[model samples]
Target: MVNKSKVTINDIAKAVNVTAATVSRALNNNPRISEATRKAVQKAAKELNYQPNNIAAALRHGKSHLIGVIVPRADRAFFSSVIRGIEEIANEINYKVIICQTYEDLEKEAQTIETLVNARVDGIIASISKNTIDFSHYQSAIDKGFPVVLFDRTSDQVTVNQVVIDDYYGAYEITKHLIDQGSKSIAYLTSPIKINIYKDRLRGYMDCLADHNIDYDERLVVESNLQLQDGRQSMEKLLSGQRTPDAVFSASDYGIMGALQVLKERGIRIPEDIALAGFGNEPFTSFTDPTLTTVDQLSITMGRVTAELFFDQLKGSKKKHHEPHKTMLKPGIIVRQSSLKKGLNQENSPISEEYKELP
Candidate 1:
């Protein structure tokens, strides 16, 4: 009688009459392992009740085969989709993921990175919190050649590899769509410039207005946390102001939801009375009283690319991206009823309704 909990991979190897090395590769799902032999080894392990020890394996290889994923919050559709994308690619390579949420707190963000490092994770993929202006935590890890890949929300202060969308382009196109719909007084809801995404989006909106010969109004630009409450406050400020905006464009979908609430409570008709647009094509955007016109960040694709960049930084990886810093994928602008003053069919964009791949 053998103890099921005490059965190890070596024990399973003996039962299958295969070398321990073969068992290890088979268990790890190495591509080189034949399917028949892999199945036989797995069967032997199951029958023997072999219990694999992750800690022991990590000690032997100096790698835990685990990576940390840090996001602002997983409750949102965008972050959750990005996580799914990351996990899919990571699992394919036999690496597991440990997800952490910062809840937009800078302290928690730094602590999460340290904890993952202490656990000896092979790498980390993170999107910084809104309040994370200081890049010291990420920079410290990068200085030591630690694998750190940032996505979506990132800081220019860090020199690490990053996967991000063309924020400027997304903003420009969305704002242009509004302008073409006769939105001359378009109010902008934005955030602090510390994070490059907001800054780029703001730049895009302003540049688009200028290109269309529209005067840039400082009173129409409201900067806040880009949350739902912040959105509401910003929208109120725009409405109560001496000059009323015909349209409102928020840097985030969360913020736009708040603005939408304010608009609805005030009995303002969407698109007709006040056109609205938002970044992050969050699912709730479509379910609103009037669907929202927003930018799709390609959350899942961003995750896969982030994972790939992390692997490129790994020591034994075959493919090395010489200059990964230039990796910037295109963004998709989704048009809907919320901002389509001229109706949905009139949207002069290749990116319409659904997210399309970049050519």
Candidate 2:
């Protein structure tokens, strides 16, 4: 075994010719010290090979300056936006974020929540996975007075601060738009309607049909996992039907792209044959051959607002006033070439007039 020397703040303070509190203030960026004094303390710290032990600091304060951010999949563009927002607020308040991906597994989500609780994180921001249903893992965190804010996806059982988009209104508007554009036979391509977002979207689609006296045709609905391949396969099955849909509304950008690929392969003209629209307003949507019409969820704003909400909770006073609150952001529809059939017939471009920048 090798003999290792322990490094302490006192050692750094001595080397810097200052008191331990000054060193601590310098390291923590307390804003009370002069700029020159901070620079000196920092240089001395670097020379001593000093590393601030966050664990020790937490032990002293009885709270960790860390926030746990949990999501179903880190690869998703929507979740990425939310994480960025969380980070923006956290950095401003001297708090750090520990991100965990659950891969849509309830067990994994629970394990990560428990681990964060054990680590004594001061707060948590989470979007529950599609498969998650249990509340035991989250209960301990809530009971311990931890600030928990659920964004995008939340559970009915967990009564905490929540930030979500208006999925129902967005979906309803798009479906009704298609119907108004003379899409008498429209099809809905979406994921499982078990979660709040998808379920709300499906409800919006159904409401649009019901309000217009259009019979709900079960044959026109195709439920898949919202994968690229699912889009292709689902569209192929729809195209094979005797009465093909004149328009299709998908709940995901990836799914829309997949359907577009299949449609293009079959030499089908967009909006002329079968119009298409999707959600998420992905970056690639605008660059597509016929720019994809989509629902802009303003994911980055959602993330930033969620972060603001988390910081508000940390501030104590605001948390007391805002706990058990909910915030809902309206989703905007992005009209593009893929869904501009009516405007084209009228010698006017709907894409130019209808597409607006999302907040």
Candidate 3:
């Protein structure tokens, strides 16, 4: 009968006719081990079905070679793209990635962070959840001296490495675009402004209106969770209100999609009867009827830079105390059929001066 026991380094070393220590060095790609010997040890390990003990290795090196990533929702294309970028970099550096989805729930996010901490992951990257008003869980991680990096939905309360897009600028440009297209009484659609990103976007929207000498009407602003159904209901409520907006600027593509559906059902021509714009530049935005004009947040690049920041923290920790690093990338506005009411004369438009420095 064949032995069913698990194969170890000793088995590979015996098969390769080398010492157990030599096998270990070869498996770890230690510079002292010759390339030929490394190949021989690897082949023997493959033949013997030897599995290296990660726990033992981690104990010796004081690092698990595992990274934890937490996001609001992994199913979203934006978050998924960020995870892909993080995974790509982690793989190249011989690190393993463990992902956790918060589903926009604060309790779930806290539990996931605690679980990762208990697992002894080398580092963590996270985007704060929408319901994360209290940051005690994140504070616990920081207090424990664990490397934590924040991206996208971040907070000023936590001082750590962060990677984000310029939300304020992106929102300003989009709102200005709507105004330049002859949209008077523009409506703003958004969620809770407690989160820094949402707050910045809301500020940008208001600032743009003030800059253009447009009155900031509180009645025209609609605040909800920014869900699809919420967006539909919000639109319905907006139309039923005393003041009707000629244009709508949504903070999320999904919400805008719902608004678009309502407008289409009501036989309102886009950019004619009521112009529209959205954020996040999701894939479906380009495929929507009349193609939605939205802002591209550079999701993948944001992820890559975020991972790079973690690596920087790791490397810098050897010298002195690592200072917090903050990186903000400029977001691009995708001009499409939905918000281009003034024809294709964007270069010579009235708002050209405001957008001259923008890409």
Candidate 4:
């Protein structure tokens, strides 16, 4: 039996009775090679179990046709949906994706970028980790003229192709909804403001409160990691404070869900006692006891658009593309039982209401 790894172009050429050069051209589908020769060479290659060295081919072509995708975590529904969206566009263009997770660690994120760069991937698609504050790592890749498109968790500090949800709009709409439902002391559970998403969201919430003539209480705004455990701890702390919040607007679905569990355990009635809302319209948000009201970031659409943007920046021709651009997908409020204390009230903010009323 022929050693699978040992099979080479010479071996295939011998079987097909052609020179190695002819075999190479045929394998590469060069127009000079006849279709019959191409077929014969390909047939022999399959039968001989000749696995082509993609890395070697990429080195010769100067294009790996491989894209590296970086996300905080693959387990989350929002990130997964974004991946799915990217794949949909990538598959059409015959590109392969290599996904890397940083688990929200800045060090790991930097390392992953370096690793992908050294691997010589044609391009990269990334969502900045929550812990990331420095733009040097991302700037380095851009300085080298590497194609990168960032989605979801992106920052204003870096100049790169960014596709993200309208975070401020999302936050404002949700906050206004809670206010419309008669919530006065609204608690905002958010992440560290180092990241743009959280910062813009916080601004939106505060601005909405101010616009509605409601007092902006610094005591009501809690900052943390915005994870499930962090949510629980933040909620517990808020409840223990001297001022009990009439509503809660968390920056993340995971954080709010954690708060939900704590609230349920403490026998607190949702919406009735404290209206609750979160960002990221995660799948489980639909099935919770009183379904969750959250912001839909158009995750899949973000992914697909980001991939398209990457291709645009990629060197399709000699034409020079200018500086990076931004695409903001309009986010909508998914009003569920959780935040519908006063159903379908007029939007207080000048921004028109875009609602997804789910059962």
lDDT agreement with native, every candidate: 0.86, 0.84, 0.86, 0.87
TM-score of each: 0.84, 0.88, 0.90, 0.91
Which residues of candidate 3, in runs, are more than 4 Å off?
Answer: 1-7, 11-18, 31-40, 47-49, 350-359
CA deviation > 4 Å runs, candidate 4 = 1-3, 30-36, 316-321, 344-359
Highest TM-score, which number?
A: 4
Itemize residue pairs with steric clashes in candidate 3. none
lDDT of 2 at 99: 96
The 10 consecutive residues of candidate 2 with the worst lDDT sum are 344-353
TM-score of candidate 3 relative to the true fold:
0.90
All candidates in order of lDDT, best leading: 4, 3, 1, 2
In model 4, how large is the Cα lDDT of residue 121? 85
Better of 3 and 4 by TM-score: 4
User: Model 1, poorest ten-residue lDDT window?
Assistant: 315-324
Question: Which residues of candidate 2, in runs, are more than 4 Å off?
Answer: 1-6, 14-22, 29-40, 317-323, 344-354, 357-359
Clashing pairs in 4: none
Global CA lDDT computed for model 3: 0.86
lDDT per residue as tens, model 3, 62-155: 7889989999999999999999989888888988889999999999999999998877788789999998988899989877767889999999
**C-alpha-based local distance difference test score of model 4:** 0.87
RMSD in angstroms between candidate 1 and the native structure over all alpha carbons: 4.0
